[model samples]
Target chain A: MATPTPTRQRRRGHDPESVLATAVGVFNERGYDGTSMEDLARALGVTKSAIYYHVPGKEQLLSRALDRALDGLFEMVADERASSGAAIERLEWVVRQSVRLLIDRLPYVTLLLRVRGNSGTELAALERRREFDRFISRLVTEAATEGSIRADVDPGLVTRLLFGSVNSITEWYQPARGASADDLADALLKMTFGGLRVDPAA
Target chain B: MATPTPTRQRRRGHDPESVLATAVGVFNERGYDGTSMEDLARALGVTKSAIYYHVPGKEQLLSRALDRALDGLFEMVADERASSGAAIERLEWVVRQSVRLLIDRLPYVTLLLRVRGNSGTELAALERRREFDRFISRLVTEAATEGSIRADVDPGLVTRLLFGSVNSITEWYQPARGASADDLADALLKMTFGGLRVDPAA
Candidate 1:
């Protein structure tokens, strides 16, 4: 028997990575609640039965996709840079790493940010997300306590605004045309950490 | 006929304002694309036909809801404060007003921010949103040109990060328990304009 052609091989290649990537794209575009197995099947160019050859089901796919984002964050939280530095410096490192992670895993992180806890999968993802928020909140509080951060603003509020600017990158960032992740992180850090206004004396 | 009672009047009451507000709530919850006419009707405790009696259709409601947010932004843009001051101060005023508007008309602005341009209504709203963004971009550029803003960072990037933080308020703000608009603006301005770090000499 003759070997399969390249076209046939490419058509049949519904690997786990490709499937997850396609599913994430469809989820981001239509929203997880709006997307169905049929939509995923159509996007994957595979029959519904063939899709079962992938991971178990939509929720499982969602779990994996959310983990792609959550795992990156958890890994960052465990990094030595995040743990060993002065509180303000550690907070800066974490924020920079988060910007890089969000850009590196843009689709997964975007999907994670939009989760509204409508299902078991979404609820679990949200709980994990809240845990991450609490970690950042502590860093902010520690920085405030150390007197590196200004004392006037609430630590909780600081966490929200600082990361809010970071997360908003997902809304408008187009990887092909946008600044590199480092450049984006630098501008964000400078604006939030150093004032945007010009210093007259300097 | 006997006069209608207050409870009966309330039950039957589906005014234009109430209908738009309810539709926006359902849209935000289920997403504009995910929500059906039936969902909006169910949310309002009315039949689908009753919804049509109040408004022409869902798109009309969306257009009105978007206008509610956009009108507030454009009004701020046209104000003397937004136009007459040093560009940096003008930009500051705009940001503060935007935070207040987002809080005041939280649902409508939330809906506006989530628009992805799927339909003609969404497309129109997006165009208006872009126009507002252009107004802001110009303000940032003007501030940079006037040397009131730091020259090293790109004005376009600054505008995005600054407003991105402001717009992110809708994702987590809970009016009943959260900080008042003035306080929220103060924190945001203090962080972005004055910087979050403690000054060494001061």
Candidate 2:
């Protein structure tokens, strides 16, 4: 017989990724603590035992989902646009790319945003989030030092406001109803940098 | 017999306001759904029946807490400083006052920010929050029209970014460790209005 195609290989129903996606939806809806392993299994139309075969428990699902969001963010920072441009340019690129990531990976980022250190899994996620913020704060500091942005406010404060504005997107953005990601990203870049950058005309 | 003073009347361990404050703490810590009446009573060192005497149930506690937050915000808007200034000035006043309220009632506002419409109480709070936003968005629109702020972005969008930056405060602000509320509010005003206002020098 011919070798099975990748699509045909998973005849059982759900793969690990697909399973995790469903778990994220349930987690976001009912909250992590409110949800149970059985809830995930029920939502996935599978037996609880079947779920255990793929992942240990609910916490693993949360960690994996948040990892996906953090990976996207870290990758954005590592991209050439974020890493090599003039400080302001780089900051703008990071902001724009972040808006794109937030919209594109709404559910995963939503789950990550809602983690409140209620458990070990959540506390670990919060740490990674801080690490990401620290990485970005360095960029803000560099931009300020380079005279591309204002120096009055603390770099760390700028990072908080910038990412806070970006993160708030997951709270209000509905893909079909609001402006497109590109449009919203453009607005974010304008709202943020428009304030941070010195007047070119002056 | 002498009528008991207000303080002496609460010999039953807690009053309605104190009970609600304790409820907000428990609700925020465990989440509204994750928390139970028994959990709340235990936290307050009281019986469930004692809690019920002051409040009907967990939902009432949530509604009461959110109402306190909402009342503070509306009061800020109603203040002469927030209501009578030029559009930009009024907006600034509202922003500064909001930061003060957030800090003054940190736990209450923190609980308010975390509501996700998981229940009727949350949904009602969410609606009131939107009303507050609508009130602010009008100020933004007025500012743009008065040539006080850039009009490139939608007023509603500006409102979201502005409040998003402000609302994110509850996430990371630790009063003792970070900038004072006055200093932070000043920075917020500078960061926001600096980008927004028309450059007089230019």
Candidate 3:
């Protein structure tokens, strides 16, 4: 073997991304504050200094994880805004896309859901989440204005419930089971938008 | 005015319960780990020893708070099960009872939701929660089997979504506001079982 390539026994260039992903997994399992850098490196099969070279510290890893989740979320909002559809159509579109975002970036979404607005970083993530909520509330208002949805309830509450429905998916969804993103969207839509109660008396 | 007796400052017999309630309020605000006995005393205008006399430690306070929430939940299940006309009736009864339970036991439920299953006591609370879930899941399965509800999806998922709809009330509910627990349950019931979409023929 030429030069005795370090790839055989060492994680060389893969250290950074691999370490970050490992950090996310650990953070999700033990929570951000509950986990330490030592635990992360041990999980990553690397020395603590090896993790340091990639990220400044655990906070940076959390920030990176949140950045990824928020990017996906904001991208979904941007795409839905541009998508030409009725308001209810747009709301459903957002729901589907949000579900996809959660599934595609499951660990990040899990971390996002667990944040309690304790840290500065977490508070920022929560604020970004509020902005996302405001976006959904506007869509719900539009849907009600279009007479596409029930006008009786507050739009904000509806938006929270909608978001809660999607966020709750991460609690039970198994990534290892290989369920597709669209499959989750299908189940959610069936239960949420489409009423579970069939219509003879509906 | 004549000098008040020393017992007057502490109230005759309600002091411990009042102190525990005050402790729960602050615990809900600051989280279990973040809160201190000093904070509890400051909230109650009592000395640190007073708090220690009432409860053994912070963990005991947490356990007491969670016990209140858990007791409410378990009672809801029992009450709903015994005082029902039909299976669907029982399900709706449980939902409304749950929303009321969350509101009546706001601080306790909030603390219960935030526990991370980190400590032994926390783990016990988590186990009790799972037992509650299994009990509700049994109701959901029985309802489906009796043909009072949709039998297409798993009963476990239905139970999760049912609580998902109720547990989320704490995120936005304000007891001081004009919005009452009944109002929340009404809106939530419509948003959940009825959904936001209009009838196709309407």
Candidate 4:
């Protein structure tokens, strides 16, 4: 099919980026399962036929939205910073980057965290999420093995709690008024890494 | 209304405690909004009429279930341990107790965490939850002022990340196979309060 006329595109007012952003906002507000194609159309201010021209169905949109979050994570996983240096340093870098990614893609990440494997797309997303968890878990284990982190607490538990704190940012973070991603990551790392208590020796 | 016959009660196999427990389980699994009275009835293995004999409606059950979690938190707030100690010690005690409370009433707390204020009952619960967060924030501030916890990080952010770790326990904690409440609390305290890094001087 030929591209739409420039005037038609201007009248529609939604590009792919805006469409996904609006769809994610609706999904987060009403929940993915509760939202409908008509809801998406209403949110986009476009007719249902126009939405179909952009995407095939709701599931396709869900897949793309989930990928927006998952892809950021996998990109972090592949980064040299995550793989190099001492295990503890690498772990710290990954956690900081994770915070940046979560903040950068707040809506998508929020949607990703709320997925419950309700459909094939959701299940796939959950699988990728688990894979990300496994990567973090390995970093924690390596940090423990290298004798940088304390040994008494289980590494698995550490991974969960550390990332749990990271994930919780999505629940309360307001970008307009909240701390920048660097400040959030610094606060989190300081609390979890250097410890929250004042050093007696200092 | 008069009580049902013992034989009938035995056949129905649900007391108030059991009914609430079962309802919370269903709520956690399917979410409060997604769950219906018919679903609760089916899960309880009783007729819809039989369910009404025990409780008035879903909202009533939700109120009770939310109370189960909130009451535990309020009880902790009322305890002498939370009030009489150094702010840092009291904060530690509160965090430990919160882990125990979340574990002890896993389903109830899980349900509480997922609430989004869609109804009067949920709105009331959300208000109570914010009150709890404020209580924690004050303790963190006190601890920082006392120079116990580090002062550089914002106390409010500290409270959020600290409890964010604690609350995340409900996401993966398995009562049958997971660590006991004491063990969980110990690990959490050691990480957030004592710090996760090994002492280089040691």
lDDT of each: 0.90, 0.82, 0.78, 0.90
Q: How should the candidates be ordered by DockQ, best one leading?
A: 1, 4, 3, 2
Per-residue lDDT over B58-165 for candidate 4, one digit per residue giving the tens place of the 0 to 100 score: 999999999999999999999999988789899999999999999988999999999999999999999999999999999999989988889999989999999899
Model no. 1, DockQ: 0.81
Clashes of 3: 0
Residues B37-66, candidate 3, lDDT per residue (tens digit)?
Answer: 788767877677776655567888778888
lDDT of 2 at B60: 76
Show where candidate 3 strays beyond 4 Å: A1-14, A48-51, A80-82, A177-180, B1-14, B33-51, B80-83, B146-148
Q: Which residue pairs clash in candidate 1?
A: none
Q: Each candidate's DockQ score against the native complex?
A: 0.81, 0.40, 0.43, 0.76
A21-111: candidate 3 lDDT, tens digit per residue: 8889999877687788788878877687776655578888898899899999888888835356899888888888898888888999889
Candidate 1, residue B154: Cα displacement in angstroms equals 1.3
Clashing pairs in 3: none
TM-score of model number 4, chain B:
0.93
User: Looking at candidate 2, what is the lDDT of residue A118?
Assistant: 80
TM-score, per-candidate, Cα-based: 0.95, 0.89, 0.85, 0.94
The alpha-carbon RMSD over the true interface for every model, in angstroms, is 0.9, 5.1, 2.0, 1.0
Residue A85 of model 2, lDDT score: 68
For B13-82, candidate 2 gives per-residue lDDT tens digits of 5767788888888887787778888898788876667666666787777888898899999988788887
Q: Please provide, for model 2 over A1-202, each residue's C-alpha lDDT reduced to its tens digit, 9 standing for 90 to 100.
A: 8897854554346778888888999988887888888888788776667667655687778889999999998888778898886787788888888889999999999999988888888898889889889889999888878777778888888888778888988888888888998988877777776753334354
